[model samples]
Structures are given as C-alpha cells and as structure tokens.
Target: MHGFIGEFFGTMILILLGCGSCASNSLKKTYGQNSGWLFICLSWGMAVTMGVYVAGMLGSLGHLNPAVTIPFAIFGLFPWSQVVPYVLGQFLGGFLGAVLVIIQFYPHFKESKSEEEGNSVGIFATRPAIANPVFNFISEVVATFAFVYILLNLGNFTTGLKPFIVGMLIMVVGTCLGTTTGFALNPARDWAPRFAYTIIPVPNKSVAEWGYAWVPMLGPIVGGLIACGLYTIA
Candidate 1:
C-alpha cells in the first residue's frame, strides 16, 4: 500500500511539474513562453528530484520510471511482484498529472492556434528533431541506456543529496543526449500523457502521433534491460 501510494503520487508530481514546464514554454501568452531547451531539461531534472524525494519520504524506493523498476526487477535489483503496481501507479499518475497541466494551461492552449505555434503533442510527449524512425529508436536506446546504467551506480538515490545528484545527471543526459528524440527515457512519462492528450479535449490540440510512440516506449525498455544486463555482468 505504501509503495503504491508513493509511486502514484511521485509519478504524479513528476509529470505535473515536468509537463507544466513544457506547456509553459510551448503555449502562447505565458511568462515562460518560448523558453529554450535548457529550460525544459532543467525543469525535468528538478521534477525527478522532487518526485524521488516525495516517494522516499512516503516509503517507496522512488522508482518513478518503469524503465527503472522493470529493468531492476529483471536483474534482481528489485522484486518482480512489485512491477505491476509500480507501473500502474506511474501510468495512472502520469495521466492525471497531464490532465492537471491541461487545466493549468487552458488559456495558453487556446492562444496557440496551430502546431507551428507550439500547440502540439510535443508538449506532453517526445518528438524527434528530425523524423527518422530507425535513428529515433537508436537515440532513445542510447539515451536511456546511459541514464539507467548511471542510475544503477547511485546506491539508493532517493536519499539525501543523491536525489539532487540524480537530477544533475538527468540534466546532463537531456543536454547531451536528449536533443535527438526529446529524451523520453521514461516510457510511462511519454505514453500516459500522450494518451491523455488523445482522449481529452484541449484547445487546438494536435494529433497524438501514436505511430511514433513505439520508439519511446520500446526503445527505453530495451535500453534499460541492456543496462541491467551490463550492470549485472560488469
């Protein structure tokens, strides 16, 4: 019960703050409007830090991303029995967080009349700077692999200064490796909110682009598994 509640609320805070940053940058007539990529990266890093802090305080290990939990489970770093609940919490919380963002930025969504003006799914999910499925998949794999691998070495990142260190790592990853595919190293972070955008009403919303969804989803899993394999081996 504690794990479920912690993961749920942790992931909720992750998306709420992270996607809120995206919306602020992309949506028109906002104070943070047109903020650059650095802004997005930094905000996401801080979001992770906050989420992990909350999750730890609430009793979970703070695996807010399934890419973290699932792979860790496969490697015996975590228990398989907990996988389903953690992922469920992540997805559902991410969805609700995104819904809250829509409510938070409704007027901004109305102001941005077209995808060109930044009213698009990119605010909630990732999109490649250059659209190439093969390379895009490669990007996600490489980025997520780097993220999860380094994360494994952190030794209980949910505690003390480690969460902040984890945030810096995320920032570095986003700045260095994320520019290619928006660095969706977290599958639940991408898909759940994407689903929300597809089903919910948002002013001048763009297509959800489910066709490209597979890259962020599968690539991160594969990469995380690879990281887990390598960590156990080395």
Candidate 2:
C-alpha cells in the first residue's frame, strides 16, 4: 500500500511536470510557448529527477515508469508480487497528471489555435516526426532498452546522485533520439496520456491516433524485457 501510494504520486508528478512542459511549449500564450525541443527535453529530465526524489522519500522504489519496474522485476531487482500494483499506480498517475495539465492550461485549450491545426494532441502524447510505425517501433525499443539498461546498472550510486544522473541520461536520449518518435520510451508515459486525450474533450482534438499507439506501448515493454534478459546474461 505504501509502495502503491508512492508510485502513484511519483508517476503523477512525472507526467504533471513532463506533459506540463509540452503543453507550455505547444500551447499559445504561455511563457514557454515556442521554446523548442531543447527546453522540453530539459524540463522532462528534471521532471524524472523530481519524481524519483519524491518517490524515494515515501519509501518506494520510485519506478515511476513501468519500463523501469518491469525490467527491475525481471532481473530480480524488484519483487514480482509488486509489479501489478506499481504498473497500476503508474497508469492511474499518468492519467491524473494529464487531467491536471488540461486544468492548468484551460484557457489555452479553449483559445489556442493548435487544436484547429491538428497539433494539439502532441502536448498530451508522442507523435512520430516521420510517421513510420516500423521505424518508430524500432526507435522506441532501442531507446527504452538503453534507458532501462543504464538504469539497472546505476544501483551503485548514492541516492542523491542517482536521480540526477538518470535525469541526465533522459535528457541525452531525448536530444539524440526523440525526434524519431518523440521518444515515448515509457509505456505508461505514452498510453495513459493518450487515453486521457481520447476521453477528455479538448476543443478540436484529433482521433488519438490509436493506430500508432501500440508501437510505443509494446515497444517499451519488449525493450525492457530484452534489457532484463541481457542484464541477467551479464
């Protein structure tokens, strides 16, 4: 129960800050409007760092992402018994965080032209820059594999430095690989918010692109599992 609460709020904070950054950059009439990819990537990195810190404080493993949780469990780093609870917390937290984003940028949602331009969905979920599922899936798998692999090896770091380093890793990955499919390396991060976009009535919202949703969701899970396999072999 304690772990569930921590994971829930930790993932919530992750999306709150991460998606909040995207909304600020994409939505009109915001201070961060048009800030470009660099700013968004940096903010998301910090979001991960903050979420980890908060989860750690609550005595949770701080696996705000299911990609992280699954790999850890498969590698025996996390208990298999707790995986369901952690994932459920993550998905719920992500949905709630996206809801918060809608509320935070209510005026923009009502007034912004992005919705009409068919670009409003990007704020809530990742979209491919090139729109090729095969390549996009590959990108997500590779990116998430690297992310989970690096994370599993970082267990030796002191608590204070671990989150910071992890944040840097995310920032680097986003800067380097995000353009391909916006680097939706965490399934919970992508799917939950996308689900929210489908249910919530944002003015002139797109169709939620359900066709491509499976790429981000399945790719990350597969990648995380592969990382666990490799880690075990090592």
Candidate 3:
C-alpha cells in the first residue's frame, strides 16, 4: 500500500508538471506560450527529479513509469509482486495529472478554434513529426532503450544524487531524440494522459489519434525488455 500510494502520487506529480509545461507552451495566452522544445524537456526532467524525491520519502523506488518498473522487476531490481499495483498507480496518476492541466489551462482551451489551431491534443499526448509509423516506432525504441539502460545503471551515482542524475538523463534524451515522436519513452507517460484526452472535452480538441498510440506503448516495452536482457548479460 505504501508503494502504491507513493507511486501514484509520484506519477501524478510527474505528469502535472510535465504536461503542465506542455500546456503552457502550446496553449494560447500563457506566459510560456511558444517556449519551444527546450523548455518542455527541462520541465519534464525536473518533474522526474521531484517525483523521485516525493516517492522516495514514502519508501517507493519511484518507478513512476511502467517501462521503468517492468524492466526493473524482470531484472530483479524490483519485486514482481508489486508490478500490478505500481502500474495501476502510475496510470491513474497520469490521468489525473492531465486533468489538472486541462483545468489549469481552461480558458486557453475554450478559446481555441480547433485542434490544428490549438494543438491541444499534443499537449496531452505525443504525435510523430513526420507521420511515419515504422520510423517513429524505431525512434521510441532507441530512446527508451537508452532511458532504461541508463536508469538501471544509475546506482553508480551516490544515493542522494541519483534522482538529479536521472533528471539530467531525461533532459539529454529529450533534447537529442524527442523530435521524432516526442520521445514518449515511458508507456504510462504516453498512454494514460491520452486516455484522459479521449474523455475530456476540451473545445475543438482533436480525436485522440489512436492509430499512433501503439507505437509509444509497444516500443517502450520492447525497448525496456531489450535493455533488461542486455543488462543481465553484462
């Protein structure tokens, strides 16, 4: 239960700050409007750092992403028994966080004429820059492989500094690889808020672009598993 709650709140905070940054950048009439990719990437990195801090205090490993959780469990770094609870917590938290972003930017959402004009759905989920599923999937796979691999090996860092290092890893990955598919390296980060976007009625919001959703979900899982296998071999 402690793990569940910790994961839940930690993931909630992650999405709250991460997606909140997206909203501020994409939505109209905001201070961070048009802030660009650098701003969003930095915000997401800080979100992960803070979420880890929050979850660590509650005795959780802060696998706020299922891609992270599943790989860790498979590699014996996390208990298999807790996988379901952690994933559930993450998904639920992600959904709620997206809701919070909608509420925070309510006026901007209302004012937008359409998704093309507002890019509202992009605030909630990722879209490929080039609309190529095959390449997009590859991008996610490579990015997530790097993410999980680096994360699993982060123990070399001092305990007190692991979270900050992880944050830097995310920032670097986002800056380097995010353009292709928005670097949706975590399944929970991409999917849960996407599910929320389907239900939440933001004015002129686009259809949730379900066709491209599987790339983010499947690519990350495959990448994580590959990372786990390689880590085990090494």
Candidate 1 steric clashes: 0
TM-score of each: 0.98, 0.95, 0.96
Q: Taking the tens digit of each residue's C-alpha lDDT, what string does model 2 give over 111-136?
A: 67566532477887888999888999
- Local accuracy of candidate 1 as per-residue lDDT tens digits, 180-204: 9999999999999999999999999
Top candidate on TM-score is 1
lDDT of each: 0.94, 0.85, 0.87
* Model 1 poorest 10 in a row by lDDT: 1-10
**Model 3 lDDT tens row, 1-234:** 877888888889999999999988887788888899999999999999988888877767888888888877888877999999899988998999898988888888877767665655789889999998899999999999998898878763224989888889889999998888998888888899999989987766878898899998999988898998899899
Using lDDT, give the best candidate's number.
1
Model with the higher lDDT, candidate 2 or 3: 3
Error of 1 at 47 (Å): 0.6
lDDT of 3: 0.87
Give the lDDT of residue 63 in candidate 2: 81
Query: Model 3, stretches more than 4 Å misplaced?
Result: 156-159
